[model samples]
Target chain A: ELKVEQNPLFLSMQEGKNYTIYCNYSTTSDRLYWYRQDPGKSLESLFVLLSNGAVKQEGRLMASLDTKARLSTLHITAAVHDLSATYFCAVNTGGSNYKLTFGKGTLLTVNP
Target chain B: DAGITQSPRHKVTETGTPVTLRCHQTENHRYMYWYRQDPGHGLRLIHYSYGVKDTDKGEVSDGYSVSRSKTEDFLLTLESATSSQTSVYFCAISESSGAPHEQYFGPGTRLTVT
Candidate 1:
């Protein structure tokens, strides 16, 4: 079984502060995805890290993957109130089909 | 937003009653998936379809069933509703099950069983 663990499930940070949400998975797989969900809304894809050393950034959020370590990280730089949401990391077991195992998600609260 | 929609956005039912959730997509994607989101369980895949009449179970597929008669529609049915089955259900679509392709989610259907 593939297990995904995320730390600081509940995070409170101030605007302009920097924080990182970590996602660690068990087993060997190469695909990792970051998704954001607002309260009572559907999830939106944030980043997809396909290989080791893969990194992608958008706005104030950056995500990186280290396949060898079975770890991925979502770095938030200069957070804003709009960044308050639940972030999830999902991993795909190596296969031709799409079967994702997701973390419990980190609920981030950005205060002004 | 993707052209995916889930019917019965909010539903309240009693235990032992049969419940069915409908997912419709206009994107013509080749893959469709059903997932349930709980407070501590981020998202658990219940079932997925690769094509018409081609469905497979996921990690938490017990007591749940799915049918995909066409490419644009996927239906998830609960044989008998239970309190443990109450959760927010989401339908997702992807162009392909291959790597590097992201799945787009529907707005989700909130189901409650008493």
Candidate 2:
């Protein structure tokens, strides 16, 4: 069984601050993904990292992946109240179909 | 937002009752999946289907069953509902084409077993 772990399970940050969440997997993976979920809302895809050293950013959120280290990071820059939500990172190994093993999400709360 | 819909958005039922949730998609994607989310545990896949009449179990698939009689519809049935089975169920579809071809999720069905 593949295990995925995310650090800092709960985050409480003030606006205008930056923070980073880490995701580490146990074995080799074909790809990595980041998703955001708001209270009482469905998931929204944030990033899909295909290779090592792959980095992608959208607005205030940035995500990167390192295949060699089997780690991924989601960095929040200048977080706002709207950025407050649960963030999840999942892994797909060997790329068979789209089977993903997800880590427990990091619940982030940004206060104004 | 790929035209995925899950029926019975919310339900409250007693234990030992049978319930079936429906997922309908209009994108004609080849893969459809079911997942459950709970506190302290992120979305865990319950089952998935690659094609019509083709289905497989995921990491936590006990007490759950699925069927795909058509490409646009997938059904998840709980023969005997249990308290532990109460969770928000989600349906996702992934197309074969496109680069960022991640799973497009439905609004989800919230089931509560008392």
Per DockQ, the best of the predicted structures is 1
A1-112: candidate 2 lDDT, tens digit per residue: 7999999999999999999999999999878999999989898889999889999999999999999999999999999999999999999852667888889999999999
lDDT of each: 0.94, 0.92
Cα lDDT tens digits, model 1, A24-90, are 9998886899999999999999999988999999999999999999999999999999999999999
- Residue range with the least summed lDDT across 10 consecutive positions in model 1 chain B: B94-103
Please give, for residues B55-79, the per-residue lDDT of candidate 1 as tens digits: 9999999999999999999999999
> How big is the positional error of residue A22 in model 1, measured in Å on the Cα after superposition?
0.3
- Give residue B43's lDDT in candidate 1 (0 to 100): 98
**lDDT by residue (tens digit), candidate 2, B1-114:** 589999999999999999999999999998899999998899999999989999999998999999999999999999999999999999999886655658888999999999
Query: For residue B78, what is the lDDT in candidate 2?
Result: 94
**In candidate 1, how many Å is residue B12 off?**
0.8
- The DockQ of each candidate is 0.89, 0.73
Please identify model 1 stretches exceeding 4 Å from their true place: B97-99
| Fnat of candidates, each listed | 0.82, 0.54
